[model samples]
Target: MLKLVQLYVYDLSNGLARQLSLQLTGKQIDGIWHTSVVVFGREIFYGQGISITHPGQSHHGNPLRMVDVGQTDIDEETFEEYLTEMRQHYTADKYHLLDFNCNSFTNDVVGFLTGGSIPDWIKDLPSDFLSTPFGAALRPTIDNMFRRPIPGAVSTPATIQPTPQSARAAINASPDPALASTLLQSVASQATLGPSSMAPPSQSTSTVAAPVHICTNPTSFHNTLKTHRAVVAFFTSATCGPCRMIEPLFDQLAHEKTEAAKLAGGIAFAKIDMGVGMGGMVGSEYGVRVTPTFIFFLDGIKKHEMKGANRAELTSQVNMLLFEAYPPHPHSKVTIPALEKVSTNPILFTQVPKLDIVTTKLCSFVDSASRPIPNSQTIKHTLSSEFAGYLRGQFSSNGKAVRSSATPQMLTKWTETTKTLVGHLPPSQLFPLVDMWRLAILDNVVSSWCATAAGNMTDPIQILIVKALSTLRSSEAPSTMRNYILTTLRLLSNTFSDLTLAHHVLSPSGKRSSVTSLVITTLLHEDASVRTAASSLAFNMAAAIQKVRIEQMRAMNGSVSGLDEDGEWEIELVSAVLEAIRNEVQNEDIVHRLTASLAFLLRLSPVYESQLAPLLEVLQAKETLQSKLEKGGCGEQGVQNNDIRSLIAQVAESLLVHMAWDNTRGGGIQHKTYRDCEQCTL
Candidate 1:
């Protein structure tokens, strides 16, 4: 799969959400739309817009529409890591009124996830909102509110808020319990304990905050006050009417403690019931004889106190908890050299192969006297050129040609002409030329200009191969012509394993450039040899992808100074290869090639292990594939190439090994663990 994606479209103007927005703001909200990107239906990524709201709860309750947009091969953990690194970029403070708003966010996210932008109708809504008089005048209010969350809007009644986790949760979740407790203790004072325990910080404020636990009795109250970094208690009795009046506000403050913790001790809000059970003893120990009293505990000491129902005093006091817990953002305090480092390195491409024998065996050129050809002079000049003459073995039998005489410029010109020439020329004309162009990329034949060819955004081989594949797509095209085109593409693809080139070559823009789409189409081609050729192409693409993936990984390990240019195409490239293997075909040789290619990809990428559905299907449904293999047996011209069952077994083994390994962690292949599998070998 290229990218697996589901879209959540929350209509901000719908139902009570819209009514409340209007009722509170006294202006019609054109729309308060929010959307999130859900990957694999487990992890969610969406812009919350600028609001005091939890993700997906846009004051709108449930979303109006949730649609499946696309599919991806990136597993949840890797994708989530990317989102974590980019957390600050999507904050409410960075939200914009007209430009960088939620819709724009959906566009960026959807484009990255699916290679397809969100619909223009949705993206254009914010600008449309600004065109109106009311929207234009209310921009400042929206912008100001975006900079700071509105009070009392942090939690939604419709959404179930997750219970706050103590450091204990971290300790229990980790495998090394001893180290886990130690590490958990270290971050307990500062870090938000879980991905969902997110609110410890709001807007520009960065501080550590933990949940407030209600103390049931004096003993529990003592542990809470001593263990927690900050503590607050509302001393109330059955007779105090004012204490009862402010109880709900106290509860809300307890729930939303901001920047209120420093160490292993965390934030707690306890109530000492003055009239019952331990309530009387707790009140007496704290010297709280009054029916209602407030105590603030910081670091095991009484730091502040309040008496009576003073809501304003309580709010002001609670707000100061954050400044006490968090340090200012380091970026706001100091600049560092590490953050500004940039790299200077040259891009490298493979040394091209000397294709003399391979080129000669693949194609032969002769003066076709039968149907007098057009462009005979240009064709022969290209064919008989010094570089081509030696590369094609058309020179003297002494294995010599004037290759030294042709400059890189002349050879580059010949390659350029050859690419366009093959586009409209008969496929029969470009065999020797194809391999020669590939060789031109090698150090022996190429100059620095050849490297420029790739960097300058022109990949002759990719361009030529895509054009040939496109032309051969015609249903009426002769089987011989189709086979010839497929062979040329396979040969052209064999020479480059560079992902930088693959990025442009395999970009999923359209049929011509979308390498995966084209291969899938060709697998459906009638000619068995053409299908076989496409499978070979699949193998070559897999090899290229694996090599590039390993190299990129090593570069990242070494801290090599370069952006991971391959990340853009890694998903599409893998999808095209795996999906091509999964596409049904009659040729067993095709199946073998596809299986081998898939095995190669699975070996290189741990992420693809989760997407083993197609592979697993081939193994479990033996009866199903047996019929397919028999039907897809040898064509009239040849005997059965290879046993499809054997090929299926090969794919099954590749999957079983990884799935079993991954199973050790929990589950895989539809969440079925190795222990769960009756036959783990399969």
Candidate 2:
């Protein structure tokens, strides 16, 4: 056992310091000798003391003691009067006599000189004597005088000798004091204190050297990017499928691209494994939640960011940005013609028929609806026939010729008629017309024209068709109309699922609900994208929910077993959906939604513990199969690391309670039935 002494000293005046030094060290000293001191303007005001009693001694060899001290300023007489008052009211012990306040002239010189039993009068002194400035100063010194050093003290000098110049270097040059203190405390049991306790160990032991790596400061990644032309950073995780997919591509670019290779220099395309180490910290700092995220930097400043895995698109964008920064050929900026010149020119403008003619005819029919012979039904019949005829004419050969010859002004007239028709009809009637245009007219009759005029359409009429269908899906539209809307959504989702077009339409930040609604509706879509997207969403959302559960578990000081048994099942379901989508990229949104749904089930269920084993087994099997395929065969090493088998065992262990109950119910059966099987060997 070792005795430890902790000293806290406060000095308020010079006289007490001299007296305390004389009494504790048996000598008059000015500076620290064997003790540590805290000076408050040169007065010994506070101190702590410790003493170790040897084995079989009266104090019983318990090797620890603690003392406290405080300092104050007061005249000797006043102090003595205070001490007398405290002695009468507080302590009347031998220790109290040792702790007292007095001036050099009036001090009990005999008590200071002789280490003997204190007088009864002195023993009755207040324990609060140390509260005075003089008493506080003497307290620590008195306490430390009884302290015993730690046992088995050994002196081991530093192995590596420092030069005189090195010794003069700043304290931080070696290692930070805080870090060194931590290292010392961690290995104190194995280490020996010496005069120069700050020095490194004398023995050239590898075990001692291992901690250095843990203590070394991490390299500053941000600082190294300053001199590079363009910094390309890849954010990835060990478990991210897209991240894994794009990693090799990035590696190829890092090796092949001349400028990129040069920029990489000795950095060697370092990877931040977001799964572990400082990588997680960096990812959090940069707000990275998804993997396969690439950040492009110019002179250490982030210029562009791409999230999700599109290797080719990422490469192209990087190349384009680099070209802009360092172009091979220079060209003058192009200027645009004045709007007035283009608008007023005869080549650009052409007169067209007015819509009033059509509007007047339609209004006249409406007015005649009150008559018995031709009422509202008759009026509607006439308008419908005329509108259909006009629309049919617009789709004929002559209509094609007129459209071909039409100028921007004439096209504008046609657009106005379409807008008027859309605005005049009720939603109930307009939905069908919109569907007809989308299905029959847009792709066949009007596609080429629309394609040519796409850039010029200030407000996209085609998007209007999508909007009308979307409205029908949400409204109390007729079942037939709703089915048509669903069909339209399915067609659109199918057409855009494999292309970047869906991403453009479904981005949460763009065109408001146009894309969001598209994605949400597609989650329920018959197409695979619906399932795929749903699964992916579900998986990501599950991770978030599980993280919350983990935090709750930690707050409650719960065991990991409870978390694994109950919380992990939902996580597994989400993970499975994500894994499925990773393999089947065609219907990602549907996959996301499916994953999210499973996650919801897990979140709402308390029987998650009961379901955990089976879920884990299934996931483990899938993972094992995937791993084996990735490795090309189930080699001995591969078989040994079969994750599914291990997970099954873990599940069995977690459900041991239920298994034990079953065993108990079966006439105290101790062995499982499988153990006696002919094919089994135990």
Candidate 3:
């Protein structure tokens, strides 16, 4: 597998040179250059010595720039050996202020990995500075500051010690004992930093805001309390054994409530250790004398307190606190049986085509475009080689294996390349690109990146889909637009893989206007393929809403209904879907999905009887669907047809029979007994 390589550039002077260089050195020096080679999730740089850390996590703070160097196909074992061998040439004692420094090390690594070097501007910064007369005068002062070692200066790699026995045993048992042994010695001799490379990967790849906030001082504690509408504080001390026993459970609660915790005025989790430095002062202020005390705060005031490591009580109190802060919606009081039984999983189109063929078709489209994009040959190579290799390695046919996500640097390069090609290609020729993206998004990493790319303003995937849909609606060549429409719908349906993106796309103002309009328009298209694809998109939207309601119902307990809180949008969806079903007479598959969409939209809805039930009455949904049941395709032609007929019958009964029965009773709508109603029966 090929790993992406990037050059992380940092300023050692931290912008001081930018402001004071003219006054101090009598020359304009933008920064004191510091660079690192970022690959394999580790940032490798030389400073007082060599060090490794998670990218962007060293003491230098965030990087000034992340330049794409290239990629390396070197195996992990071989790369470790290379780094071990490079250590002898770049030893700590031989380091110099101007000669062999961080930039020198990065340049060598870049050349070794990609047969290329770091940018010339960065590599020659020292020369550029020394060329000025003023810079030449400060040479002795810089040398003294770095070379005149003070007492108790931190030791370098030459003074390292041996590895532990347990660790050595584990290394010996590893598949490649020699590689593991070499890596351990290298890490021990150099300053090993961050988490262990051999540690198991985390299960979740989605980047969530830190679920818990560690507060060691009064200022931070007060700030968190004032910001969040609800706060849960777990106060403990180092010497307390019960505190250790309950810490994991406390962390579990924080992660469980992370979604609500990320809202603007949402709840927050804070941890305070009384045994630690300013932690004692903060805990004392709250009259906390015992370890493992739990406190609940609302609007920055104490509301409740518990005084033990009781797991059950902690869980219950947290739930009640959440319930108090965000009460169940008013819609939760209604009852609708048919809507309750609807499935919550969205309908996804996940058929994968041969990636090699897709790459060929895409390259052909780009090769023949009137204005070719820059780097056309390189782009084709990436599609056929690196991109294809990445997807194939990450996904398998059985689909049971768990895989890690692409690194941020890799994702950045892929998006930039794909976005350029997409912008230059015509809509009619975008089918292949859209198909590739449809498969790419099945990987959650790409889906998550596209969802948050530039806050969706310049999201490449969304732009591609919108452009294709615009063409599908207006194109005179129906034959040419068929595949485009089909792939575009599948791409939209796949957006539900990340629920955050799915909800945002279906938001009141975001993608609603364009996506809903296109799906509704295509629902009545002449081609059966277009209609099938459109129905799948419609079903996905409904299923997403249903999923949220079901989750809300579970969270709030079964006493109330689960509501999506958007009545206007639901009404529009129901109207469009009912019309589509009535007009769709030939395809049982299309009717099946459309009927399921209706069932999900009206199911467990807080306003089903009030808003949706009356809309059903106005549309005469019973007569429309009963006629569908009488259509020849809905008869006993096959097992699938019978299932479709049964679904239609259930939907009509819940929508029309319940509404008519309530109207006759002169009472507002209520959940009536479910049975065969005369107007609608399978």
**Could you say which candidate leads in lDDT?**
3
Give the Cα lDDT of each candidate: 0.47, 0.34, 0.67
Q: What 10-residue stretch in candidate 3 is worst by lDDT?
A: 200-209
> Any idea what lDDT model 1 has?
0.47
Best by TM-score: 3
RMSD of each: 23.0, 32.2, 18.4
Q: Indicate whether candidate 2 or candidate 3 has the larger TM-score.
A: 3
Point out where model 1 deviates above 4 Å: 1-379, 390-407, 428-458, 497-512, 548-588, 604-606, 609-647, 653-682
Once model 2 is optimally superposed onto the true structure by TM-score, how far is the C-alpha of residue 84 displaced, in angstroms?
92
| 1 versus 2: better lDDT goes to | 1
Ranking by TM-score: 3, 1, 2
lDDT of 3 by residue, 130-193 (tens): 5432233333333332332234554332223344443333333222335434543442222222
Q: How far is candidate 3 from the true structure (C-alpha RMSD, Å)?
A: 18.4
Q: Is candidate 1 or candidate 2 better by TM-score?
A: 1
